[model samples]
Target chain A: MNKQTYFKKFKNIKYPISRRGLLISFMFYSFFHFSRKLYANGEIGGPFRDRFQSFRQTFRVEPNPEEAKRIINNIIKGRDKRNNLILLNAPDIAENGNVVPINFSVNCSMNGNDYPKVVHILVLDNPFPEIAKFFFSNQSGSADLAIRIRMRQSSEVVAIAEMADGTVGEDRFFVDVTIGACS
Target chain B: MARKNYRRRLKAPLTAKKGEVITIKTMAEHTMEPGVRRDPKTGLIYPRFIIDSVIVRYNGKQIFRSRWYSGVSENPYMSFKIKVEESGLLEIEWIDDYKQSTFKRSVINVLDNNGNEIFPIRLSEPSQSENLQ
Candidate 1:
């Protein structure tokens, strides 16, 4: 049947007001309300919740082992193997936190077949831990990169590299900051 | 609006041979504000301050460009390598999000394999040596 005719047929139909109908209608309304409540609560646990949690954890000035593991697992999920990745962390005593130099090198063949696809660097302790993402092609020649990053406090830096073979490699470095970046 | 007290220094060798990769390092002084902090006295959030882009030109030809972010620390420092093909003017310009800008220029002279000057150029302003000549 056409959609218009289907709707028109039901538009005027009225069922008798019986106990069974009332109970079924009540159950349907209750289910709808319950689902709405569940959805509203789930909104608090959305993807951005991890970002908010990271911000809060930085301010609390406390070490969170669970949060650290979550970050590691996320990195592992995005890594690709067949590329040699090296992650270098800044020295523990950073004279200046504002412009800490971080260097990364990948021992990849750099050939069209085994080139590195992407390099992602993250500072797990920073307000925004996703520091930088670099896309490299064969034109890059070498997979060595150097960049400066800001850190609020001493934290661990993680580097993940994805290779052409669909394998993942990772390295981590711990940095100590004598001077905070915020200052 | 407050007067910013920052400076940048870019250094590279004045001469290189053709097809030689030269390392250039630049250090700039500026506060890279992340805009996430509130002033204790005024309770006002500071606007983000960062060097947004840098471009290097060789004789009016674009050679290198970089995009920066707040993740880069204050008083930013960057180092990169570029190949010198011939004698030309090397110009570097830095621009910040606040619309403040600065430019630094250097003359690059390419030498031959035998260390003989193939292209001679001077970048500094007329000095005592030039005055004597």
Candidate 2:
């Protein structure tokens, strides 16, 4: 059976349908239409019928918890192990959110398969959850970095270290922002 | 289009011991616009303008790299560590979204035991002249 023969056979075959079957299918379609109208009118989904719209606009806001979770999940994939391998140092209170000084160091010797390949920084409440990513080589003695980042509000800063080996670790710190930055 | 002048700065220890880790700090002036702010009068959104990546190379070999998003504050400052095996030229490059790249370089002299500077290439050896047959 070649593809052309199969297509010719399908074209020759007829799907037999009775008048009663057509009438039943029309009724089913009408039922679906009515249900759709009810859903649009907020009667089907009850109080949370507008959740879909809210979900669509989830990435627009600064404090988007769902989007942050999605970004973390995408980064870590299935390897979600939290350990002390990564130490994230961030201020407990930042007077100005425009520049929050933060640093991170990985507890790994720069030996064969002990160093970190990439380290990710994420601000859970920022509009863009992923703040930065650092890539280190063996010549990079220490997997440590210090930088300044902007935060829209007080949020948990997460640092995830993906080691050269198949291991991953993360650390989180909460910082309170007295004045948030508009980004 | 007229481009704005961006100031770049790089600092590293001028001298260090062999097999020692040294810290390097780099700073670049950039607006780092997040593209979400609106103008007060025109209500126009500003386009995103930021440094996309930073690469650190020692003796022309890359040792460290970083990718920055708009979350990085204006005039970004970053510091990291690298192990020096020999004296070499260190370069830090900043690449922005506009495909413009700016780099700052510094030379470090690595000293071994007995306070002797180590050079990547032999300075005392002379090259042999090519012989034609």
Candidate 3:
């Protein structure tokens, strides 16, 4: 039971190496490795690769142009009643994009069908376009609001007012942001 | 876990004439994380934590409401207008993304043309007056 005898107990045991099994295992490993490389390089997985990843990882999500358009259209719908109902006031030049002061007022009298049901604020270049929405009731004497918001870049800020009588009014304002804010 | 204390500020007129429009301003102290900014040291994205909605109620009746997203700036400030007919309590509630809510309350005094303050509930009645007599 000495250490030297215990270490030499199985020193003479021998095993045969099979070249066929080694070749097969190597082939499987290489197949998987190469396939993964191909996938990582976008040589395979065409549809999925284009939409998701191509190895360049970015923390900030890119703003989708089509999605912004879709949201604008969804708010305006087909009935674009271009009128002087909604008056949006935003600074033409924002020194700090982190806090952009914006205010909007609806000319409606807040009576029966003239009052605004909802006023939606959208920034076209932000990753998430829809910013805020205001719901007003008859008790809300005036449909006016002032708020502070964040902007990723210089873009058109849109305010769409949907009235109770099935009418919609849209207003757009362009803001020049000196320094973009990350959202 | 919501460990930060959100400070709320509400400003409204103490008194108003009947059918007069009054302006109300509200502010809430919050970080308003947009869920996209990464930590510079660890490179980990900060989760979105923002005030989701704001509700303004007059005498327990909602008069104005708002829904907000991550685009709102930190320490959000909002101001709106409401018409008052009778004196009532005004409550403004700010609801956060984690379902945490904070509110502020203020009482408004509505007055009539004769400058008599309109009480929410009638104080004097014919039976009461007769009993007093």
Candidate number of the best DockQ:
3
Model 1: per-residue Cα lDDT over A1-183, one tens digit each: 899998999768887886798999999999877865554443433322344422212122333545655655655664544344555646667877877888877776666667657666777776555555555555344666677888878878888786767777888888888787762
For model 2 chain A, give the 10-residue run with minimal summed lDDT: A50-59
Which has the higher DockQ value, candidate number 1 or candidate number 3? 3
Candidate 1 per-residue lDDT over residues B1-133, each given as its tens digit = 3456357788989988887767777888777766676788997777666677777777786755655655677667766566666777888888877667788888888888888765534445478468868
Taking the tens digit of each residue's C-alpha lDDT, what string does model 3 give over A51-131? 233222335788876767766665666895858989999999999999999999999778878898989898888877778
**Model 2 whole-model lDDT (C-alpha atoms):** 0.82
**Each candidate's TM vs. the true structure?**
0.59, 0.77, 0.78
Report the lDDT tens digits of candidate 2 across residue range B1-133.
2345378888899999999999888888777777777788998777677888999999999989898877899989998999999999999889977878998999999998999999897646545223221
What are the lDDT scores of the predictions, listed in order?
0.67, 0.82, 0.84
Per candidate, chain B TM-score? Answer: 0.80, 0.87, 0.88
Better of 1 and 2 by DockQ: 2
**Two-way TM-score contest, 1 vs 3, winner:** 3
**Residue A31 Cα positional deviation in candidate 2, in Å, after optimal superposition:** 37
Model 3, span B1-133: residue lDDT tens: 3445488898999989999998998888788887778888998888677788999999999988898887899989998899999999999989987788888999999989998999877759787688778
lDDT of 3: 0.84
Interface RMSD of each: 5.3, 4.1, 4.2
Q: In TM-score terms, which candidate is top? A: 3
